[model samples]
Target: MMDRRERKRPAAQPGSRRRTAALLLGSAVLLAAALSARPVPHEVVVQFGDDVSAREAANALASLGATVLWVNRSEGVWAVRMPDPGEAWRLYDRGAERVTDAKSYSST
Candidate 1:
């Protein structure tokens, strides 16, 4: 007979592993839902004359690794859809200064 002071060991439950796996899956799903709940930023569109072709603007965006979501001509302008304002500024800054400099030089 065992001593009365000694505690008996409890048996391991069969579903413990399954319970742990389910908890992990539930946590992953919750994390994904939380992340996806945030809203996406709006894209920026730069418009030029319809005389400027989509191919021209697409090439400009491609230089910055941005996708051209859409391109359409309205009135006399061709509106280019860029991924977001950040990308728009990046592309604008990269080339705009040079064009401005060239125009100033030619005008003078």
Candidate 2:
């Protein structure tokens, strides 16, 4: 006679297959949602030296293909969306007194 341990296992319940299919569908939906999300744009706050004119700063940023969102002439700051990380360094090399991430800020 066959041992109890060697006997074949019972078939899965009818509802289990539906549950598995639903789980798989949910997972696929989640994956699609994640894949469809776009990456956040890179933004920077560039401060120019006192001697740099607003026109000069605007020209420089335009030459780098940056999208100027805002300009604070009194503070000599420009909020710009750069295409990539390397552009921040390029801004510095181009005459930015300081280059910092746009998200870096203090509420107070």
| Steric clashes per prediction | 0, 0
User: Per-residue lDDT of 5-93 in model 2, one digit per residue for the tens?
Assistant: 99999999989999999999999999999976754467888888888888888888888788999887474789999876576787776
For candidate 2, report its TM-score: 0.58
Top candidate, metric lDDT:
2
lDDT of 1 by residue, 17-83 (tens): 8999999999999999998876444444454434545565566667755544444444222233433
Give the C-alpha lDDT of model 2. 0.82
Considering summed lDDT, which 10 consecutive residues are worst modelled in model 1? 96-105
Off by over 4 Å in 2: 1-40, 106-108
